[model samples]
Target: MKVGVVTFPGSLDDVDAARAARLAGHDAVSLWHGDHDLKGVDAVVLPGGFSYGDYLRCGAISRFAPVMSEVLTAAQGGMPVLGICNGFQILCESHLLPGALIRNDHRKFGCLDQRVRVENTSTPWTSSYAQGQELTIVLKNGEGAYVADEVTLDRLEGEGRVVVRYVGNPNGSLRDIAGVTNERGNVVGLMPHPEHAVEDLTGPGTDGIGFFTSLLESAATA
Candidate 1:
């Protein structure tokens, strides 16, 4: 499988994402934010970093990048997309996934190994995980709190759209949500850095490999 990792100006983790993809047994393609083409990648990943210096909002400027047009269309067409941290903010900004990532309630930048429960394993990015499985991954961001209206929150909960929930409230997110997926389960967004955990020497463990491996497994099954 070929997975494209997009790099916008100021993107810090594109290289890490590509490395993770390679380690997961997929060809990793470096995609530029200014390009409209996806280069025939089977899946896409929006890695973390402060795009456009997070000027207008965490992901506000990145939502208008040229590459996002293709990403938006492909994601809607059932191509798997995983957005991590700042990437998750971009996904929300692009409306590919619902809800918003606001500033942490404590008004501080947070960085740590966080415990998250895999609530929904049906998504392409999560198939390698068992339901209710808890794993630790790196979480770092300034605006990581996820928020949505009561009705939307209710719908997400009722439909099992909630993908990951924080073991402990670290960012004051609504209902302790750490990640979510679209109705089709093709697109997923999370604030934790799964790519950082793909190697044991570099992270808590290799548990993060599941995110990339899950996509390949899902594709093979399909």
Candidate 2:
């Protein structure tokens, strides 16, 4: 499988996301934010970063990037896309996923090893894991709290779209949501940084490998 990792201005984790993809035995392509082409990648990842220096709003400016236009279309066409940290903000800004990330309830930047429970493992991005499985990944962000209207939250819960929830309420996200998937389960967004935990030598551990490996396994099944 070939996965593309998009790099926007000020993006800090594009290379790490690509490395994780490669470590999972897939070709990792570096995609530029200004490019409209996807280069025929089977899947895409909008890695964590402070694009445009988080001007206007976190990921608010990046939602208008040329690459995001393509990503939006591809994602609607059932292309699997994973958004992490700042990328998750962009996904919400683009309306690709539900809920909005706001300032942490503590009103401070949080950086720690966060434990998240896999709620729905049927999505293409999480199919490798069993439901209710818990894993720890690096979480670092200033505005990572996820919030939504009660109706929307109900719909998300009723439809089984809530993919991951925090084992501990670290960011004060609503209902302890750490991650979520779109209706079709093709697009997923999360506040934690899985790319930072894909390797044992340089990261916390290999707990993050499933995010990449699951994509490959999903593709094979498809």
Model 1 off-target regions past 4 Å?
Answer: none
lDDT of 2 by residue, 1-222 (tens): 889999999999999999999999999999999998999999999999899999989999999999999999999999999999999999999999988999999999999999999999998888888989998899999999999999999999999999889998998899999999999999999999889999889878878889999998898889
**What are the lDDT figures for the candidates, one per model?**
0.96, 0.93
Model 2: lDDT equals 0.93
In TM-score terms, candidate 2 sits at: 0.98
Cα lDDT of model 1 by residue, 1-222, tens digit: 999999999999999999999999999999999997999999999999999999989999999999999999999999999999999999999999999999999999999999999999999999999999999999998899999999999999999999999999899999999999999999999999999999989999987899999988999899
Superposed by TM-score, candidate 2 places the C-alpha of residue 155 at a distance from the truth, in angstroms, of 0.8
Looking at model 1, residue 182 earns an lDDT score of 94
lDDT, model 2, position 163: 89
Clash pairs, model 2 backbone: none
